[model samples]
Target: MTAPYLIIFDVDGTLIDSQAHIVASMEAAFSGLDLPAPSRAQTLSIVGLSLPVAMLRLAPDHSAEMRADLVEGYKAAFQSLRLSADGAALSPLFEGAMSVLETLQADPRFVLAIATGKSRRGMEHILDQHGLRPYFASVQVADDHPSKPHPAMVKACLFECDVPAARAVVIGDTTYDVEMAKAAGAQAIGVSWGYHSVEDLRQSGADPILRRFGELPAALERIWSLT
Candidate 1:
């Protein structure tokens, strides 16, 4: 029998290393709002969550008014920084990311999509800027549905791709991604190159955390074998 279709990736740390921009923007946001900013390590831990979720984690004691203010401040600061960088805000894609996508896209049995916490507009901007837009068949973004740790985003991607949950795998750098995949009844594959440590990912219930991007195709082949 043919192997099952596989792979939905989280964009931020999984494909592209945007941690610097993210943390900088977040720090700027906190400064603008006069709120205490989370440290880089703290911010990294919440990377896969939605903006609101990240804010809540960073400022759990914030009032509703404060939350609104912080959100607005964050958007303004982030946009300003991104614009000031002249489109250079994005970090480079992980090593072999393009090659892995190309290899998988070339295979008829494999399918690829994006499941990310970034807003649809945000994700589109990054993908288009990097000339990576055409590679994904479907994109599941925060604006389109609920955020990570919730299966809605992954479920939407599964629906868009017309694939059963059992045939799909979610690959990401954070624990939130693993939990979301588990909630969706899909396999979870974690990449050690991203924000979270390998031990953290393992504790998050990711099966077989991969140390390098080059191992992805073979790792995925193994997941597909089960379905």
Candidate 2:
């Protein structure tokens, strides 16, 4: 029998384009707390990391207490701004995302999962709000495990799915995802339609940097063939 393929996706940039919301919410958080906000470049640089890690990156000199305060501030600001003036949070999935997800989910050969920096509650909120909660067979969130570059979260997903590392593929838009996949001995596929530039993804050691979401199946097929 052929081995099952486990496709683990990162939430923010890979599956959904939440850059605007992320940046705007973060800026609001800083402003609300009277703290120095990071620039777009700085924000993009830490896209796939956990909240505390991202906070450390942005405010290295901040005390642990201040970091905790900043996290709370960011979450409050995000919750407030996520909803539009019309009282709805508009989350736009990337082009061809739904079709691709549906296609992959329907395939008997593929097992879909999520490994994101978002907390489990945060991820569940987005999935439920977007009507995408039923698709994934497994999910590993930052709050449940150590952050990316540690591979613990990915390993957790693998454990949940009962798959070996070699049978898994990690998909994301950031270097952190690629690095984590490498650490976990899984194939890494980076998406160009995210916070990191193509060059950045390539430099981060992704085997194939996908330009379109539609190309995901083909990329996975290629990786499977090699493995």
Best candidate according to lDDT: 2
Off by over 4 Å in 1: 1-4
lDDT tens digits, residue span 153-219, model 1: 8888788888899889999999999999999999999999999888888999998799889998898
Residue-by-residue lDDT tens digits, candidate 2, 67-110: 88888888887777666672233447889999999999998999
RMSD of 1: 2.0
Cα lDDT, model 1, residue 48: 83
Tell me the TM-score of each prediction against the true structure. Answer: 0.94, 0.94
Evaluate residue 142 in candidate 2 and report its C-alpha lDDT on the 0 to 100 scale. Answer: 85
Task: Record all residue pairs in model 1 with backbone atoms less than 3 Å apart, i.e. clashing.
Answer: none
List the candidate 2 regions with Cα displacement exceeding 4 Å.
86-90
